[model samples]
Target: MSTVKDVTFDLLRRLGLTTIVGNPGSTEEPFLKDFPKDFDYVMALQEASVVSLADGLSQGLRKPVIVNLHTGAGTGNAMCAILTAYLNKTPLIITAGQQTRDMLLIEPMLTNIDATSLPRPWVKWAYEPARAQDIPAAFMRAYATAVQQPAGPVYLSLPLDDWDQPMDATDVLRTVSTRVGPDPARVTEFGARINAAMAPVLVYGADMARGGADVWADGIALAERLGVPVWASPFCERPPFPETHPQFAGPLPPAIAPLSALLKGHDLIVVIGAPVFRYYPYVPGSYLPEGAELLQVTDDPDAASKAAIGDSLVSDAGLFLKALLPQVNARVAFAGGPLRKPPQTPTGELPLTPAAVYATLNALLPDDFVLTQESPSNIPQLQDQIRVRKPDVSYAFASGALGWTTPAAVGLALAERQSGRNRPVLCVMGDGSFQYSIQGVYTGVQQKAHLIYVVLQNEEYGILKEFAELENTPNVPGLDLPGLDIVSLGKAYGANTSKAETTEELAGAFKGALDHHGTSVIVVPITRALRGLLG
Candidate 1:
């Protein structure tokens, strides 16, 4: 009889989970004892980075990736990242060690207390095997649940000593449907409505990109067929449509009243692959513009249910776009000039404006390069200034958390290697957000992951300050961070580092990072301006 570890590894290999991301501990040693030479283990310095790195890899690979953590303590460290993964809709199989079964009642060191509940609400499914032999079976369930429609993280707890347990292994390989197709009648009805409407606007989100290249093309084709203006969803975490497209009308504001006002002229508002609305700051107003009807297509039941007002079709974004394409007519409304003008490149000024940085990057960045951005205070400029010209080229935080993207840059670099695309990855982050997962740099160095970190150092939490102003709160303490040698820190993590105080220097630093094979950090001290939200 094969032992649990033997069978589990075989299963994992078959499932394409050969690369495991983890931050290990004593409780996890048994499972990792004599790790297979054929398998690769990506070790992060902290559990938070471990889970987050895996999240990026999963998204890049478009599959479920397994992550190992050190029992309860490790899970606690990774909870915030798990939440990020949940919001990102990335498929991850998260496994953690539980103290030996004999110590469960005694609650000894590293013994998980309520293990299943730890990652809950965030995870689609969470479970600890009922017995040692059940561990392999549990993983299968976890993988299936993780990749189902509206993919997200799943949790499993394995006892340390259970790896050696006797188990009779049999072929457990099976294939499951990963996408939910739109209901035929509902889709036909949606098509009819689109044809009947005199004016319709298409709003899209990350799912269009997540659905893969074919799906992204379908989105552009569908938009062409309908001849409708396209608006990006509020706080969209990925680029579904090329920002440079002529029909693109830019992003919609997140608040309720303004969001409706922007769509007011359209008789039909068709939102697909995103939530009906993702709003913030609690601006109360009509859910939809007067005389405008809304229809949403999404893979998530939760988003469909929580939608304030909309007729929803639960379906894969790509499938719905494909199905509705032939039913619609090619119209002349789309054959027009650009809906928005490109921001003019800024002139070099002292202590460069955020627009200058974005404009410089916009000019320098390669068409195929991938960008992960987290500079919240500079979003308005980043949006109007920077442009994504390719499909699946942008990613950002949906969980409103810091530190995810910096480490995610590393994972994306690894993903590039795995996929043989080897695209250069640039991570744009604020100074305050850099500290949250700085340890990820060390991991990147060890892995020789090639990426760049462009830090916009304003010496303060500009986003938080903006929020305070919006909320009428003042004199907030501990907002300023004046001292830190980021150059030294980057060097300590074995990265090439540079600082730029002028636009010319900034361009040089960015170019150096692009040419370098490994990690680099370019810190630029920008003008400190707290641009208010919706500015």
Candidate 2:
């Protein structure tokens, strides 16, 4: 008979989930005791960063990753990143240790109260095994649940003593298939719609990127074949289409009114691998463009069902695109239209505007670098200036949560190293967002992850300030976050830190940092200027 820990470790090795990322505690020690030599453990200072790290690693590896959290407090701290992972459809098997099984009647300290409900609605499944001997089987189920279509995080609570139980000989392993094909009839109908529409617009979503680079390539081919413009989903977390493509239309605004206005001229809108729409700030507008038909192709049935106005089909995004491509014949000749370019906003001196800084970086960024961003106030300017020309080259928190980018960048850098891809990872963050996960720098230093941290210092929560301005509020306290020394913080975490006061300084810092190895942090203090939303 194999022990519970022995069976679980073997299963994890078989599933390629031996790389565990987590922040451990007393309750978790039993599982970690006599840890397998084949398994690698990544430790983060906080639970939130731990989950975010694993989230990015999973995305980069294009596989489900394992995460270990402490009992109650650790799970609570990880909720934010867990939610982000759920929204991003990233597959993760998250395990939390519980108090030992013996102290059931009298609750022990650090014991999770109703542990299954902690990550409710966000996780696809949650459970604590009914018996100590069933722990390994429960984990196998968790893995299958996490990797299924519309994949998301799944939770497992293991009693501290469960690791010592013996497994029966009949306790064997099984395989689970993750992909499901679309209904042929539905695919045929949607393909016919594409073939017949006079002006059909393609709205690409992060799902394509999450699906893998091959799916994104197919989407490009489909767009080119159809001779239609492609617009990225509003606040898309991944780059679905190359921004530099001539037929590429910019992203839609994350507001209903603006999104509706942008899609008005199209006769049909086909949304693929993404929600029909994701809006913010509660702007009153029609669910869709007047007289335009909406059709959504997604792997997520829940997203389809929740769509305000659309006909939806649930299928594997890659398979759907592949099946639909041959059926879509090109009749329109509008694919050669010139891509719009943003006008250069000149800031001739020190204390540059965000636009000027972004423009400078755009000019200096290497072709092979991956970009991660979390500066909402400067998003409009960044959208205009920094152009992504390839799939999987950019990432953001799909949940619109702060603090994800910093640690995610570290994870990406680590993933690149593991995959033998030498591309540099660049993480751009607003000062406020940077502070939320600053300890990620410590991990970067320990791991020697090759990353460039760009701190956009506007000295406040600029996005919230903009929201206040839009609400006509004259004054709002707690909006300012001045006097946060990003350089000192980075240096304390053992990163090479520097400050940039102008575009020239920023250009130099970026160029030098990319050439150097390990982690580098560059703080660019920019003048506060929120640009209007992009069309």
Candidate 3:
């Protein structure tokens, strides 16, 4: 007979989870007893920061990451970050220590009102094993569920008392099977329809990256052969195509009305990996253009099933791309006009422009660096000024959640270090969002990870100002942030800091920070009035 701790460690090792991220609590002491020397534990101050770090590691490493948490309270604390992981479709196996198996019936202290339902709709699977012997198998199941198509987070509630109980550990580890290609007839029909269309647009999603660059290149080849322009899905977490490619049409419009209007002239809209479109609130428009037809190819069954206006085929993105490659005839030449350029920044001295900052940063950053963007007001500017090379190098919170960038950057830095990669991790976060998880800076400092945090100090919730103006509301509450020193905050977290009021100063600071060995923060003073231009 083996103790639960031994069994859990074995399961984790077999599952390739040598790294664990968590904020340990009193209830988790039993599980933490006799911690294995082979595994590395990444400790964060808050549970939300723990999960967020794990999320970024998963995306950067392209592997399932394990996260531990305290009981109900810890799970609740991590819920927002968990939602962000779900939206980003990151593969994570999250485990939380329950109060105790024996005390569960008595509703003891720190016991959740409903443990399984707490992470609702965010996790692919949530469970509490009935027997102590079942813990190992349950862990394996969580890993499998997390890595399955439409990869996302899974939860397990581990009772503390059960860790000391005897349990058998005889189950062998098994490899998860990859998804097969779509039906041959369906592929043929899709190819034929695409060839028949006058103007077909290819919208690539993040899933394309899951299949790797070879698959992505194959898809791009097919699209090019068909004379189609490739556009990234709205709010895309991955780069559907190399932004440097001539065929790339850049990111889709955030508003549905404008997006629908843009697609009006196209005869066929073929979306791959991503959904038809993701819209924000108050975005009014029909699902599709009046005469245009829609088609979807995705590895995610949910995305395929829920498509409002398209024929969907469920299959591995790479396999589908390979199978469809030979069926389409090559066009004489790819046909597409110049890509749409985002609004430009005006030269100024009084108020700083977000566009200028992004443009300068783009010029300053090396080609190999990774960027984690959380500045909602600078979306258009960054997307326009900085062209991404691939999906793996860029990440943004799809759930519209603030405070995700700080911790996520820590995770990416950790993953990069673990993989022996030398590229710098650049995190662009707004002043408002950075305050949410600034504690993560300490984690980066502790790990001695190479990270540069660029705080876009706009001194207010710029998005709210846009909302207020949109609604014609004159006065808004809680929109202004004044007299805050972000440089001091970074210093408090043990990070090297710099403040830049102009583009030239910012460029100098960014260049210096990128070469720093440890974590560094650069504060760029921006103006609230420049926010609207990014839209």
Taking all chains together, each candidate's TM-score versus the true structure is 0.98, 0.97, 0.96
Clashes of each: 0, 0, 1
TM accuracy, model 3: 0.96
Residue 55, candidate 2: Cα error in Å is: 0.4
lDDT of each: 0.89, 0.87, 0.84
lDDT of 2 by residue, 79-123 (tens): 999999999888999999999989955888999879999998889
Q: After superposition, how far is residue 316 of candidate 2 from its true place, in Å?
A: 1.5
TM-score, structure 1 vs. true: 0.98
What lDDT does candidate 2 reach at residue 55?
89
Q: lDDT by residue for model 1 over 1-535, one digit each (tens)?
A: 8999988999999998999999989989999999999999999999999999998888877888889999999999999999999999999999999999887998997788999999988999999999888888888888899999899999999999999999998667677899999998998999999999989999999899899889889999988888889999999999889889998999888899889989988999999999989898777899898999999999999999999998999999999988899888777757778998969667677688889888888788876888898888888788888777678788887888887987788888899889999888888888999999999988878888779898899899998898889889999998888997888889999989999888788889888888887889999888887779766
Counting only residues 3 or more apart in sequence or on different chains, how many pairs clash (N, Cα, C under 3 Å) in candidate 3? 1
In model 1, the worst 10-residue window by lDDT is 342-351
Q: After superposition, how far is residue 485 of candidate 3 from its true place, in Å?
A: 1.7
Identify the candidate with maximal TM-score. Answer: 1
Put the candidates in lDDT order, highest first: 1, 2, 3
User: CA lDDT of 9 in candidate 1?
Assistant: 92
